[model samples]
Target: MSEDPASSRQSSRNQDKTWINRLMSGFSSEPKSREDLINIIKEAAANQLLDDEAVSMIEGAIDVHERQVREVMVPRSQMVVIGIEETPEQLLPTVIESAHSRFPVIGESADDIKGILLAKDLLPLILNGTEDFTLEKVIRPASIIPESKRLNVLLREFRENRYHMALVIDEYGAIAGLVTIEDVLEKIVGDIEDETDEEDEDGFIRKVSDNEYVIKALLPIDQFNDEFGAKFDDNEFDTIAGILIRAFGHLPSRNEHVEIDGFEFRVLYADSRQIHLIRLTIPES
Candidate 1:
């Protein structure tokens, strides 16, 4: 018997709707577990009802609620800072080198953080000449936050206050690190690279095809996970190079390859000191 094509297509769509309804039934009745919701989101993503980025964001939004400030802050040691004694000549060069909008002004030491410095504030020093450089005149009060603060709460404060950056403090009130609004939002929406961010000199992750990417070995592991929807353990390693070193038990030479979980990582450029570039492959299901 010949089936009517339009009727058969409509029937298939109806069956799909029924399946989706069954999956969502628990959400309205007894309530679905976290795993159930995650599975449902994944199923929706696979069915093209939601995009991959949207799925990543949904998962991120859930995961971020459980995280605290310490999880995503840039360590104090890595923060770009300006010394209180820095001259206008020195300050301008330092700001230009860092390419950051704000810098923590330090007093005698890193522990003695004075206030926040806006790079644009230095414009007056340049425009009027470097005769007088009073950092106090240009300083904005720093926002101090405890390292234990929940990300969701921090996000609300950021939105309400219009503050872009904050200094993270320990229980003893010593600077632990720093967190920016962008960092918190990145937890929910993924890496939000600005136009001013310099492109990776070695070539950052480039999509060559649907399931393959040519990446710089120095690319941060967290950034990679956000882009690819993969969960690689990032507790001990920061970069793809770090992962390769752990996998090989030594620095990997060019063309060396390793497969962890389901993704394949192949070295594209390297030296004895570091891995430079890599090719990543993920087989489509």
Candidate 2:
């Protein structure tokens, strides 16, 4: 006789609940704070009741509640935007070069954001005819949000509204930056590499330009030195992130940069615990 799948699933769920209850039973009282709860979870992981990835995800979920949109948004200066007055020929190169799915369409300046232009929306114009193409016709209404909005709330809104991108504004209603669904999700589950991310075969580093590169914080200091022709001490710190953290004296936030030995190291992606990725800009010799 074949085993019942439903019964097997129920047994598995019951076993999971039993272990979870056992883990909680060790606590004399309910967790008094988030930190205490996290400590309990860490203990469970240490005891083999929970895995490392599960602990990380739970911590990330808690961290999201404490973070605001401003913490993870791509700054206005780095935003790749399309001018409303730009022609198809002019904007195509930007769309292709940036490799971004959505771009904010600006009217006069970066402050005067009109709407969002999706790269896929241009397919029909390219195939049919460009003569009838106008950015005003294909642009979608942009979602506006404040920089102070919390990540958890933003994630809920993103799911409920079915939109991916939002323009973040400051107290004065000026565009501060932009945040995406991926950015918020990354806070919970860590980095989500898409097809657009062009990295080396080892996935440790990606050259952005002649003098700039995006690198994983886990890249060994020895390999980094060999790649960049710079001598950084690896005896004290194994990875570039260790050297950076020593220089920073604390866990740095996204977009924060520090110059060490003529090399500009900027935090690209990081959370409460540690830095994940960085942008390295080599100085001209």
Candidate 3:
């Protein structure tokens, strides 16, 4: 992803200023006149200068439509789907097992999805009636996405439109998976947990596939360094994102992969040159 022409020119000006700042990094003696440096900075900013930091942010804006739900999804394997004819006894157990508050009701499998069901909706059925309970009556239809929509755009879509989940589709446009508000939020602010969430030393991280993990970026960087025993260098970056920009050499589009510390970091959403959303895949051993 590249910046707009106006923004690009501004970035060029900013890059020059970075060089100026760097040249001045270890100065033992300050410049004789403060006006010289002040004019340079004022000129750069007045011209709308931007540094590498500006590029990271601009890339997020340019690459919005290219990410997809599957890239940042709660995969089907981890999904909680129930058949339309599923008995309340069967339904209750699935809900309890997942500790999820919602379920998708389908006629046969998840592909034949009829609607979504919230656990609270099941409360009335739990105490009194299993006899007339049907999965179809309690589900909601939601917006869907292809496995190619950009996470940044999706984040805006989610925010402006207030969509909670988007059903991910394959090229043929059938549902291949789903992404939730939590899934998108995980990419941005990192993982979130509730009362029922399980705690493993591997705690809270959901292992959806062999290589893919739903983990919180907030988990201490040192913790990852210690746990995974990786030799990742965090020179100027404190989070996974700072490291990502260092690798790509520029801001990247959504779902674009780069190998770092033996794992593939896929951009889910990046706002302001920072990784607000991402999908991590372990590199092949």
Q: Please give the CA lDDT of all the candidate structures.
A: 0.82, 0.91, 0.65
Rank all candidate structures by their lDDT, best first, as comma-separated numbers.
Answer: 2, 1, 3
RMSD of 1: 11.6
- For candidate 1, the TM-score is 0.68
Better of 2 and 3 by TM-score: 2
The TM-score measured for candidate 3 stands at 0.54
**Mind giving the per-residue lDDT tens digits that candidate 2 earns over 238-281?**
89999999999999988899999999999987888899889999
Q: What TM-score fits each model?
A: 0.68, 0.77, 0.54
Which of the predicted structures, 1 or 3, would earn the higher lDDT when compared with the native? 1
lDDT of 3 by residue, 35-127 (tens): 454444444445455454343333333333344556567656667787788788777888888887766677766677777777888878747
The TM-score of predicted model 2 comes to: 0.77
**TM-score-better candidate, 1 vs 2:** 2
Off by over 4 Å in 1: 1-5, 30-33, 201-285
